[model samples]
Target: MPYIWLLPAMNKNIVLASTSTLYEGTYLDYLLPTIRELYQGVTEIIFIPYARPGGISHDDYTARATDFFATAGITVRGLHTFDNPATAIRNAAGFFTGGGNTFLLVKQLHTLQLMTALKQAVESGKPYLGTSAGSNIGGVNMQTTNDMPIVYPPSFDTMGLIPFNINPHYQDPIPGTKHMGETRETRIHEFHSQNAIPVVGLREGSWIRVKGNRITLEGALTARIFEQGKTPYELKTGAIIPF
Candidate 1:
């Protein structure tokens, strides 16, 4: 039988995207429509750039997101610029967390004691968007992330906004290749060997949409699902994730 985990009653409005940029596309080019809908009626939002992709400064990362959201008539301010990030999160109309190194991002959030605050804010129905490493934090923990351990966090525990974890940027093995490296599925299976949490392998161009208590897969492609013991399966687009 397939595994099922019940989730708590929630008031979440979140978009956990697999990646920020798609092949041959500009930053956030593909998700602009979704962004408009997710943050509807909200003119301003806070951008969490703690991931700091490629070691870019917070200001630079924020600028990248700012430029992208501007097209949708929304303004973005970096969380690092505020006196108290936790306070800012509570006050912000919406939030967007850009992609980068998951380890570094988790460390900063934990070190600054803002994880719980952010979680509370989002749980209160504030619109929240996460891409790549940012989306990893939306899971039960960051253990399924595809990032190097460049920094250690106080704990692997994430916000647990969803009942299960997610493996962002999930890819399938090529039909015939001699590379012999461990596939993404292999790593996830190993995780199941020790952990019971279900994992959704979110492929590029796909995202998980959360509205209140309903969680659904969004995009044109199918998503791979993995449970502890059952054989992995594919979830079609627009289908509610069974957790």
Candidate 2:
């Protein structure tokens, strides 16, 4: 089944990326076209909005997402009406995950055992798209998420659709603002100390498109790869990393 899964894995199936959702603007110039291509058509997208880290209810999130899609004139709905989640993912032309707190998303995914069900959908050649926290779940694990893992995941095992970790909102070290316990550089350095996992720093407007092993960088500049014991290196346009 491993090799059997590899074929579809290498074929066109999933779209995992950070959120291009600017508050007042649409993601068309940044996000929608790639989704349209992945689904093989313009699809009526579904939003799963569970923010607030382990204590979120899906209502307000859903309402906000509905409004976002409605503005673009695409029929969008929340993945809540159906009690049977397998049925929910199975019936859809494509699945999109909106970003919030990745730790929260993973906690819910584990608690519900939706990981198995969602993985089944991806393996069957269905398109799966994740944004921000959504994209974080595509990696080997969510260890790199800026959010604290207040709730444990089903597994550190992410969707494994991608080999690297994603650090969305990849801002350079802030000079004077200190809100979280550690400085930006200190936090990332701590992450490096704990794991050797390669992390990809994605700026707000940037993303990567995985179309059958052709992992291409989009939006602007290049992706920064950070690892333990080694100096961070920059991978520019047309670089195909094994991870």
Candidate 3:
């Protein structure tokens, strides 16, 4: 059976990947095909490297994405390449936000006043792609992120492109393990204590495909969803999320 429902009227396209890399090959190797399909008409992409995964420099991060997208015959230019970040996003053919520290990314976005521009572009029917912290910002706020507060932004609020929150790199409690850290589930429960917005725990291999009002869960794994006052439930692959 087909797992994806083609919605031509969606008017917007977004890819929210839990991680940029999976198990090994290369950055976005696991999702290159999907990326290609989602970004069909896009020729050049505006890369937002503020997240700076591994504390890498923005130029370095942009270089990595440039190399990856080159495989798809698409050109990638960093937002920093332009004199104005907001203008860069507003005029891009497509948008891609790489993963790193969600706080840092949010800070840069708000600092440059590009956050609203990004939301406007996406809502205006531009194709958008995000991974890790990038995907976390697609939600109502970054409060559901698992990353520590390395920096403070003007607000925890994000693009709110999607109605709910996204908990990327979600992991379950390993049985027979001696680790005493709070499991991802526990932390999400704590988030629920204060927020009513539902959170989808996207495992490393899982992704959410957003086309306007419809969202479909993809990949080989099941996503864990946490709702207020309700037990976190597993949403299997091919499930259509009620976002």
Winning model by TM-score: 1
Q: Which of 2 and 3 is ahead in TM-score?
A: 3
lDDT of 2 by residue, 1-243 (tens): 679757876765666665547457665346666655676653476666644424556766666666655555556667765697667766766666777788778777777677767776666666777778888887878877777666666677777776778877776767676666665456667888888777888766677777766676676557677777777767785567546
**In model 3, where is the ten-residue run with the lowest total lDDT?**
1-10
RMSD of 3: 4.5
* Clashes found in each candidate (C-alpha, N, C closer than 3 A): 1, 0, 0
lDDT of each: 0.93, 0.69, 0.89
lDDT of 1 by residue, 1-243 (tens): 322222223568999999999999999999999999999999999999999999999999999999999999999999999998888988999999999999999999999999999888888888999999999999999999999999989999898889999899999987898988899999999999999999999999999999989999999899999999989999999999999
Error of 3 at 120 (Å): 0.6
Tell me each candidate's RMSD, in Å, in order.
4.1, 3.2, 4.5
Candidate 1's C-alpha runs over 4 A off are: 1-10
Q: Looking at candidate 1, what is the lDDT of residue 127? A: 91
User: Ranking by TM-score, best first?
Assistant: 1, 3, 2
- For candidate 3, the per-residue lDDT at 86 reads 86
lDDT of 3 by residue, 1-243 (tens): 343433322567899999999886679999988899889988999999998877999899999999999999999999977898887887888899999999999999999889999988887778899999999999999998888789889988899888899999998899999989888898989888988999999999899998877888999999999999997789989889876
Backbone clashes counted, model 3: 0
Worst 10 residues of 1 by lDDT: 1-10
lDDT of 2 at 89: 69
**Model number with the top lDDT:** 1
